[model samples]
Target: MKTLGLIGGMSAESTAVYYREINRLVRERLGGLHSAALILWSVDFAPIAAWQAKDDWDATGRALAEAARRLEAAGAEAIVICANTMHINAPQVQAATAIPLIHIADATAAALTARGVARPLLLATRYTMEKPFYRDRLAALGLPSLIPDAADRDRLQAIIFDELVKGVITPDSKAAALAMIDRGRAAGADGVIFGCTEIGLLIDPAELDLPAVDTAIVHCEAAVDFALG
Candidate 1:
C-alpha cells in the first residue's frame, strides 16, 4: 500500500475518527490484520483556530503548505487534510506537494451523487457553511446545497466549536440539529451532508429521513482506495 499523508488536528476529536476509519477500511479490504501505511502531521489547533478567527488564511495556507512539504519529503504518496474547514488551504498544500490531495468535498460530492441526492442540507462550521470554497466546489460538481438560516448557523457553529470539539454531546444540541434538518426538509432539501468531520459524532445518518453523506467516512474510503491502488 502507498503511504497516505494526513494533515490533521484541527481538532483532535475528528482526526481520531479519520485515523480509526482509515485503518479499519484498510484491514477490511486487505484482511489478515492489514492496516494503512500512513503518516500523520498533527498540528496544534490552538494557534490554527486563532489564525482562523483573525481571518489569516494566508498564514494558514503557508503553515499547511510547510506540513505538506514535510510529508512529501517523508515519502507520502498522497495527502489528506482531515478537517473540512482547513481545506481552504488545499490549493496551497497541493502546490507544495507532488502527491494527490484527497479532497473531502470531492469525496462527499461523489457520495451524494452516488445516492442520487441533487440537493443536500450542509451542516458544518460557520467558515465552511458561510464561505464560498466548499459550496462553490459542490456547485461546480453539479450538486448544489442548502445551509441553515443565519440564526441556526450561529447555533450550529456554537454546537461544533463549544460542544462537539470539546467532546461534549448534549441531547439538546442533537435535537436542535435535527430541527435544523427538518427545517431544511421543509425548504426542499433532498438529503443531508455531515459537512463537519465531527458532525457524525453528533448526528447519526441512520436516524435521518433523508439520504445522508458523512464526509469523514467517504473521505477515508477514498483515501483507502488510493492507497490500495
Candidate 2:
C-alpha cells in the first residue's frame, strides 16, 4: 500500500475520525489484520482557529503547507487534509508537495454525483458554507450546493466550533441540526453533505432519511483507493 499523508487537527475530534475511518476501510478491504500505511501531522487547533476567526487564510495555508512538506519528506505518497474547513488550504498544501493532495470536496462531489444527487444540502463551518473554495469545487464537478440560511448557518458554526470541536455532543444541538436538515429538504435539497468533518458526531448519515454524503468517509475511501493502488 502507498503511504498516505494527513494534515489534520483542524479540530482533533475530526482528525481522529479520519484516522479511524481510513484504517477501518483498509482493514475491511484487505481483510483481517490489514491497515493503512499513513503518516499524520496533527496540528494544534487553537491558533489555527484564531487565524480562521481573523480571516487570515495565508497563515493557515502556510501552516498546512509546512505540514504537507514534512509528510512528504517522511515518505507519504499522497496528502489528505482531515477537515472540510481546512481544505481551503488544499492548494497551498498541494503546491508545496510533490505527491497528490486528495481533496475532500472532490471526493464528495464525486460521491454526490454518483448517487445522482442534483443538489446536496451542505452542513459545515461558516467558512466552508460561505466561502467560494468548497462550493466552487463542487460547481466545477457539475454539482450545485444547498446551504442553510444565515441564521441557521450561524447555529451550525456555533455547534461545530464550540461543541463538536470540544467533543461535546448534546441532544439539543442534534435536534437543531436535524431541524436544519429538514428545512434544507423542504428547500429542495435531495441529499445532505456532512460538510464539516465532525458533523457525523451529531448525526449519523446512515440513519438519515435522505441521501447523505459523509465527507470524512468519502475522503477516507478515496485515500484508501489511492494507497492500495
Candidate 3:
C-alpha cells in the first residue's frame, strides 16, 4: 500500500473521524490484520481558522503548501486535506507536492454522481457556501448545487465553527441542521451534501430520508483507493 499523507486538524474533531474511517476502510477492504500506511501532520486550527475568518486564502494556501511539502518529504505518496473548507488550499498544496492531493469536493461529486443526484443541497462553512470553489467543482461534474438561503447559511456557519468544530454536539444543533435540510428539500434539493466535515458528526445519514453525501467518508475512501492502487 502507498503511504497516505493527511493535512488535518482544521478541527481535530472531524480529523479524528477521517483517521478512524480511513483505517476502518482499509481493514475492511484488506481483511484481518491489514491496515493503511499513513502519515498525518496535524496543524493548529487557531491560525488557520483566523485566516479563514479574514478570507486570507493566500496565507492559508502558503501554510498548507508547506505542510504538503513536509508530508511529501516524509515519503507520502498521496495527500488528503482532511477538512472540506481547507480544500480551498488544495491547488496550492498540489502545486507544492509531486504526490496527488485528493480533493474533497471532487470526491463528493463523484459520490453524488454514482448515487444519481443532480442537485444536492450543500451545507458547509460560510466560505465554502459563499465561494465558487466547491460549487464550481460540482458544476464541472454536471451537478448543480443548492445552498441554504442567506439566513440559513449564516446559522450553518455559526453551528459548524462554534459548536461542531469544538466537538459540542447538542440536540438543538441537530434539530437546527435537520430544519435546514427540510428547507433545502422544500427548495427542490434531491439530496444533501454534508459539505462540512464536521456535519456528519451532527447529521446521521440513516436518519435522513434523502441520500446524503458525507464528504469526509468520500474523501477517505478516495485516499484509500489511491493508496491501494
Candidate 4:
C-alpha cells in the first residue's frame, strides 16, 4: 500500500474526521488487522486561518507549499490537504510537492457528476464559495455549484469557525446547520455539499432530507483507493 500523506490540522475539526475515515476505510477493506498506511503532518491552524482571512495568499501558499514539500520528503505516496478552504493555495502547494496532491474539489466534482448531480449547492467558507478557484474548476467539469445566500453564508461561517473549528459541536448548532442546508435545497439545488471540511462535525447524510456530498469523505475515498487498490 502506498503511504497517504496528510497535510492536516487546518481547523483540527475536520482533520480528525479525515484521519478517522481513512483508517475506517482501510480497516473495512482489509478487515480487522489494518490501519491506514499514513503519514500525518499537523499544521497550526490558527496562524494559517488568520492569514487566509486576510486574503494573504502569499503567506498562505507558502505555509501549504512548505507542508507539501516536507510531506513529500517524508515519503508520502500522495498528499491530501485536510481542509476545504485551504485549497485556495493548492496550486502552489501541488507545485512544491513531488507526489500528487489529491484534491477535494476534483474528487467531489467527479462524484457529483457520476451521481448525476449537475447543480449542487455548496456550503463552505466564504473563501471557498465566493472565490472562483473551486467553482471554476467545477464549471470546467460541466458541473454547477451554488453558494448559500448572504444570510446563510454568514450562518455557515459562524458554525464552522466559531464552533466546529474550535472542536465544539452542539445539538443546537447541528439543527441550525441543517436548517441552512434546507434553505439551500429550497434554492433548486439537487444536492447540498458539506463543502466546509469541518461540517461533518455538525451534520451528516442521514440528518438531512436532501442528497448530500461530503468533500472530506470524497477526498479520503480517493486517498484510500490510491493506497490499497
lDDT of 4 by residue, 100-193 (tens): 8888988998888777787899889888989999888888988788888888788778878888889888988888777776777778888878
- lDDT score, candidate 3, position 74: 95
RMSD of each: 0.7, 0.8, 0.7, 1.3
Ranking by lDDT: 1, 2, 3, 4
Number of the top-ranking candidate, with lDDT as the measure: 1
Query: Which residue pairs does candidate 1 place in steric collision?
Result: none
lDDT of 1 by residue, 56-162 (tens): 99999998999999999999999999999999999999999889999999999999999999999999999999999999999999999999999999999999989
What TM-score goes with each of the models?
A: 0.99, 0.98, 0.99, 0.95
lDDT of each: 0.94, 0.94, 0.92, 0.86
Off by over 4 Å in 4: none
What TM-score number comes out for model 4? Answer: 0.95
Q: Which is superior by TM-score, 3 or 4?
A: 3
Q: Candidate 3: lDDT over CA atoms?
A: 0.92
* Candidate 2, superposed: residue stretches over 4 Å from native: none
In angstroms, how far off is 171's CA in candidate 4? Answer: 3.3
Q: What lDDT is obtained when candidate 4 is compared to the true structure? A: 0.86
